[model samples]
Target: MSLDRHILSFLRALVSSRERKVATAGVVIGILYLLNWSQRKTSAKISLGHRSKKSNKGTVDLEFFKRIIELIKIVVPSWRSLEMFNLVLLSALLIARTLLSISISSVNGRIVKAIVTRDFNLFMKRIIQLAMFAIPASMVNSGLDYLNHKLAIQFRAKMAYYLNQKYLTGLIYYQMSNLDNRIANPDQRFTQDIDKWASCLSNLYSNITKPCLDIFLFSRKLSDLVGAEGPIFIIGWYFLSGIIIKFITPPFGLLTAQEQQNEGLYRACQSDLVNHSEEIAFYRGNDWEKRRINNTLDKIVKHINDILTKRFFMGTFDSMLVKYGATMTSYGVLGLPVFGPNREKYFARIGNDPSSITRDYIRNSSLLINLAKAIGRLVVSYKDLQSLAGYTTLIHEAKVVLEDLANGKYQRTMMEGAVYDQKSRGTYIIADYIKFENVPVVSPNGDLLIERLSFTIKPGMHTFIQGPNGCGKSSLFRILGELWPLFSGTVYKPPMEQLFYIPQRPYLPHGSLREQIIYPHSREQMEKLGYNDEYLENLMRIVRLEDIIEKRGGFEQVEDWNDTLSGGQKQKVAMCRLLYHKPKFAILDECTSAVSMDVEGSIYQHYKDNGITLITVSHRESLLKYHNHILKFDGEGGWNFYTILPDS
Candidate 1:
């Protein structure tokens, strides 16, 4: 009978609240329409559990947060001098906001009390108090929001800096791409995902902590007015709504992670198309590329649609359970002051007559409703919680992988057995030869590329390496540069500072022509090293590239060098950069492939004239004349080294 009475009271409350009826009807209609539309759609499954198996396994589990907490310990100190101060200030601001929220609710209740009692003096006094209280409340809230965003930005910059340092340290980035690749689109993770993670995480701090604080403070204030029943009933309902919402909310974390992964794949595919646009155009493969891109897009759209469907159902339940549901619950509980067995006791505590008691009931009920609404908003933000979890997982996993690579925990096996000779001390630094002592080179995945090879490049010796494609001609250079690990035996080369690498497709960074010539080094560094474009122009003239620079006005014109220069012209700029650095040993791996033979010859001759020991990897027979020795691979893990005859 008691349960029946409670149910009857709840229904009566809902009927009396006109806004509740309208909102409930709208939500019900929207949910039904969506369900019908979803049934008609064939792209998504009705069941939330029917997600991709890969997404389930790869999605960041709760353990990811444990790891993130550990990583936070490492990154938080990166705030330097503001570390403890930032924490203290943020805590204080959040507390201030929570207290202000409670004060606002109290003021609102007081205003209701004043109006219902028909006390004009009390009404004006409360209004004045509210006005004065609102100024500092608004200011504090603004400061809290500002500090929140500032802290998030600072955290992102610190974490990004750490990731950059780890990624760029000692060819770990190369190994991650080639050898121990565990994550896709690491670039995207660094550029886009980290920022999202920071924002979500910052917002999550407030969303979670503030609600907890409000529940405590508001419940205490409510207990004094309606005794224990009102606060207890509201609290229990909030938790019950949360449990029901959680049961219906899909695996949004997994779906969001899958969505981000698909986005990365699409971006990677688009980048490939841009990089290889000319080749695809030449082959007239536009349709094939479009189909490939569309396939990736299809996956993205499917995931997004699934997420929306889940949100629709969840949002409907949340609205019905939180908005109207809270109103009904609050009315049933707060109605005690008017109709409960303890009504006389409640009125006696306020020491008021019927009209004054009625006014007190209005003020107290309004405060109860306000508190319930605040808790409802918190409960309804389950989607935001899921997004936060997804981002946290990605960032945590990426941070772990990056830190592992940086710490040498995920090192390649080839690096374990290789030897580095440090015989030359600091005095004169005389190790100037390149020696391959019975060396075996293997691909990143342990596929043998070369076996038991031995050769040496004497000082001032120009060598040409020849082989069929995928026969490890370029792999040899990777080994020599220590970018790839040696499979077996030893590779002895001059210190990295004295060596340089030039690949087939040169990378033209976004900067001025002068910066291009002195890439990876600023103009200030060039000036400090006593090098400048005045001498670089003469080297370009030797390679027949001076006219190209002159045509562009001068050497310091800032532009997107990659888009501005042709393949051959880009190769010429690379040669100019090579000359500017002028290392003792230059590894040219088809670096002049786009240039004409005569221009290539001129570039090679210039290296020869400068006494730069050249190790060239190319298929051009014409290059044989520029080299003093030939190291030829037989494409079967065997190679032969011989001096080039003067005629041959």
Candidate 2:
């Protein structure tokens, strides 16, 4: 895509997302309205009026609006002059939101009722009926909702994955470990918050769109009942009510953000114990850790209480909404007689004999009541919507990193799957034959580690990395593997498919031995990697697992891997998997450290025979003979590279 088109695509996607949110919000509201409306039969209303007590007149029945203004002046004198504006705007929105909520709840109620009654056919038909109205609107809303959520998740996951990948990239992980905890618990943000934000994104999207949708769709349906002029007045009331809510609510977004951070921070302290329970027991730091965790918890809870206080103040507007709702009823009392003729007037409203006009008058009054009830719900929902906006902003902050990670420029690559066309060979390469320059990896805060790291291991060149503990050997390995970016320099490799990074403790997913063997590679790719049934069988035997395979499972049948395998057996299985992949260079970050020296030697020997370039990190003196050279980091930023000879 062209630059402009890509930008447009992104914007259009976002706008489309917002539109969907609005729509889904509407559908939920609509469904609620329908269900709620179904249960509620309009009760017979008595046309009670505000009697005007004057010098000559005994009791003149004033219309709804006069009663409204009187009530508004009495309750909130601040809204006295702008009472008409207040009632017109505030009341309608309040009513509309309420109506929508009622509708949604009612629809939900009906759906629930249908399920409860086991009246599937009626439920289905009711669903079908609502679906006709809701589906299209919901489709738009749901589509928007899905898009928004997907964008959010994509954004969140990308950032988290990126930061995670970046933090591990250039020994930034080591730096982050040492950095003062400004971000008290980053793991909370990465693992839990990113996931929670991603997962709850749909709900957040709905929260926004649903209320606005309630306002719009509810207004649409309500306007149909109330007429165009009525909607105008109603919207005016809605607007006024919204403004009041805005005035009452401070920018709680920052507060909410802080609260989440604090909560995560507190959780992080608790999680530390859970993750290190064995270590705590081993060291007998039980009281220390508990005290430490509790201190963190206390800090978090303190912030939470403060946030709740802010929320409580902002929420006091509900009382205001209730007051305005009563005022709107007053306006309705005034409006009735003013709009209709003298025959429709309240003084002559009741007759000795009840007639059809009396019935119509009663019906109108009830419609007015229904309209009023809807207004109240709309107002309350608006306040809630404002509250959720804070969460939405936090969600947006997460998206930034996610987008960059997922689509940012390609970094140092060491592997490529076979590209059929030689014409495409020169396309992606930045410089000449894949090189690794002096790369200094650092954090976003500019903390540095492992500087002047320049090493180029060409294809089929087996090299090993040796360093003392915490000298960033694994970090360098991570950089070499392309999981972490080189902060300053470049790592050039053929493509993504030609190399593999094997860690100290290889990750074993909960699956069969067969499944575990080809963990990341797809089934088709597993075949391409030359890891079929027979190849796997021979490899298992090579790893001394022929008896285990035969006794437990041939190929098709297998037990749960974690439950079945011993620690040594798991290590051997990992070695077998490494052989099966057959990548050009395998960067092993102490992968075989758990195995005995003899088994480790055999695994290395297998690599030598296969001609696979081996880049390994190990403290063991026994494994050095397999590699032609060793790149050693001396804790300081300095690194020494030298050729080693076994026979020297």
Against the unseen true structure, what C-alpha lDDT does each candidate score?
0.75, 0.55
Task: Count clashing residue pairs per candidate.
Answer: 0, 51
Q: Residue 367 CA error for candidate 2 (Å)? A: 2.3
When summed lDDT is taken over every stretch of 10 residues in candidate 2, the lowest stretch is 43-52
Candidate 2 total steric clashes: 51
lDDT of 2 by residue, 1-648 (tens): 444575588678867787778867866985675454333211101111121121101111243224323322332345333333433343344334444444543454455556655778978976875565564445444454455555455545544655566555543444333322233455665676556444443344345444554546545653443344554665566567666665444334444555677687678677878867778899999889889878877877876775575556445445545455445643544344434234234345444323323433343344444444445555555434333343333433333333333443321222244212111111123332245576664432344556556676765566778777767776665555554545555766755566776776567776666777776666688887555788888888777776777777566665777557777777777888877777777878777777888878877888778877788887787777788778888887778877785411
Tally clashes: model 1.
0
Alpha carbon lDDT of residue 540, candidate 1? 80
Which regions of candidate 2 deviate over 4 angstroms?
Answer: 1-242, 252-256, 262-281, 285-304, 307-316, 323-365, 406-451, 454-461, 487-494, 528-530, 547-564, 646-648
lDDT for model 1 comes to 0.75
- Return the top candidate by TM-score: 1
